[model samples]
Target: MVSPISLDALQTLDAIDRRKSFAAAADELFRVPSAVSYTINKLEEDLGVELFDRTRRKAELTPIGRLVLEQGRQILKASEELTALVSQAKDGWEVELRICIDSVLTCEPVYDLIESFQRIQPKTEIRLSEEVLGGSWDALCDDRCDLVIGAEGVSPMPGFSIHSLGEVEFKFAVAVDHPLTELATPLPSSAIQDYPIVIVADSSQHSPARSMGLLDGRSRIVVPTIKHKIEAQCKGLGVGYLPYHRITDALEEGRLALLTLETPRPPEEISVAWRRGNSGKGLKWFVERLQQMTLDPKRGLQSADN
Candidate 1:
């Protein structure tokens, strides 16, 4: 038997529930308020359920109405996915592509690549978000993103493919006026232990959070991004190892000074990664382009195409 509910009515219900008024829903749906009201009224008549408590001044969903709205959103989401899947099947590209970028790397080069990609596939939407450390890999593993750039720490799991973007070297640095700056080269751990250390907090949600250059019993100042860590160190708030590429200006301007450490941080190997079995042209385009290049510490993504 055919159900009395229609997709259009469900959409109107959702719009009203979200927009909070018939007039607002009408504006969103590009229809007159009467049309929006009529749709809801007709749906109520067919279903024999009052979706809203009309006695209230503001449009509010009843308990049954809330249940319907909750279920209706899932239906709408599935419908959208089916439509996009059909479109993707026809063309080799996807309707949208989401990319997660590691916070250690600058986004300028990635933006340049995006500009190049849009020349061919302008209709496809590109979404970019920044993740720190293992968060990039976590985003891909959890299906939160289709592709990741500069993913580090975790090795390739069973579902995704990865290609090296090369290693980023780190340098032990402190503000020029910091107490550590006055110490001898190859500063002893005992001398450094008294000062505070700055660090970027890991952004991973599912995996264990990772940190670098942290010392036991040392005062720590934690910030959200590498840029912030750099700023904090420059202000004489703390001392830590920072990516050499990101601090050239600070060093040249005499804002921060590098120190030799007995135990230096090893260079980190970063990579471009994407979930396997994704046939979308956007992901393939980036994977191919990124695999040919290496992440230059001073120059960002380095290749002939760049």
Candidate 2:
């Protein structure tokens, strides 16, 4: 009678503690505020203890409530790991496959692969997240994703199955009307510093943010994605590097003019990484197909598996 609590009630209690209010917790759990309150009340009724201080304006956890939360999170995590372990050992397919995609790569191509994969294995659900630089790796290392594609380098933390996707050539480019084009070819760093460089901010949460191609003491316009950086550069709002593959048509059509740097910037090396372990059929299906796919220069996207 006074022994164990349901995982559902524990989860509701944890959510209430995290969100700090019944209504807010309801919003997070996608349930009605009354439902959240009822769940908490039922949990307290079963546990034979008061979990919150209703006298205060804010929801303050009682001493016992704090104790429940501290242990509740552990139970939630262990439940997740066990579920994954069982899925791997007993069932070849996973319930879902979470992937972290780098922003520099286009989503259309990856979607193509997803479409193909679903034909053969329609049960596994796929969720995709876009991360920049170290954020992609962080997602995999933090167990947020089963696979990471277009990550900046070979797996930095080790124990990941790393494979080179290919190196992307970076070209110093600006709008046709940009003052940078008026400057002499092979722009020098001193001359370059006069203009603002557009950059994509790294979106790492579990790790420190990474900056790319930021000159010391130079002004920069930091944007959240590659598309924004492209738009800013196309309007002559800033000067910076764009992936050659991305700007090929723009360069040919005169929307962008490639500027030669006195010291050329190196191409960005990219790789696909996944954690070591049986990731189940969904993830394995992705890895095997991704390894065979390559960027098709003629079509301007990844082609069918080679």
Candidate 3:
């Protein structure tokens, strides 16, 4: 029969890997260097493998030891979380909840929800992730998030529960000093293609990526977030569409000019997406509050004018 791995041995391995030396790990753990070495040898003998390269000045993990260390880190994380889960079990609270927000959204709207959640379940840990475009949807689909807010409301994937947020308007905006400002009304696709467009790279992992407002042959510069895209456009580095609500003040102040395209883009109806089954009580409570969520009336336009 195979021997079962001990959690103490795993911790010792991690301490050694992290410290890069048995002497240092022993110091950190308040044990003698010999005791630490004994633990390592015992673990290796139990697993029937060499765990460290003693030939090196600093002990380095063997190939299989590196793999075990990686898996051990995951187990260590799960074990720590198990304590929190058990502590909250009597009250039906989640040990952790991950929320992914779209970069297009301002966090001000969710502050109240967070405050309320903390009041209701003080023990539940909350994490927030900011993603652009399909990244939010991909987070929920890939199990990285319990709920994703401001994902594209429409997607090809099935098995998700989508709750509408509101329609977000897109404006073809450029810096006031750009050549596009000199272009006559109704900028054609052909002329627009000559200028480079800045786009946010999708952070999706599993879902097939999607694109919006991009032309067939336009030169493109990709950025990580909506804020970065806006920054790129505002510096006259490139041109592209931005949310009208986000750029309204800039447009009115003449910092960014709205381009009247020959082909107008439609508003995106954004929403929250999460998987449908076995949601924890904490998740259920949050979803009820999100259902009553409202959009800002100052979102500017319902649709872009052609």
TM-score of each: 0.71, 0.68, 0.67
Model 3 lDDT per residue over 25-78, tens place: 999999999999999899898889999998999989999999988998899888
**Model 1: per-residue lDDT, tens digit, 1-306?**
887777797899899998899899999999999998898888888889989999999999999889888998888888887887777657889788999988888888788789999998876889999988878887888889999998875553677788989898899999999877777788777778788888888888998888755765278988888888999999988889998888888999999999998878899999888877999998899888888788778766677566
Best candidate, lDDT: 1
Model 2, residue 29: displacement in angstroms? Answer: 37
Clashes of 2: 0
Better of 1 and 3 by lDDT: 1
Candidate 3 weakest lDDT stretch, 10 residues: 297-306
Query: Per-residue CA lDDT of candidate 2, range 150-187, in tens?
Result: 88866657778987777877788889998777778777
The TM-score between candidate 1 and the true structure equals 0.71
Q: Ten-residue segment with the worst summed lDDT in candidate 2?
A: 297-306
Which rank order by lDDT, best down to worst?
1, 3, 2
What residue pairs are clashing in model 2?
none
Q: Model 1, clash count?
A: 0
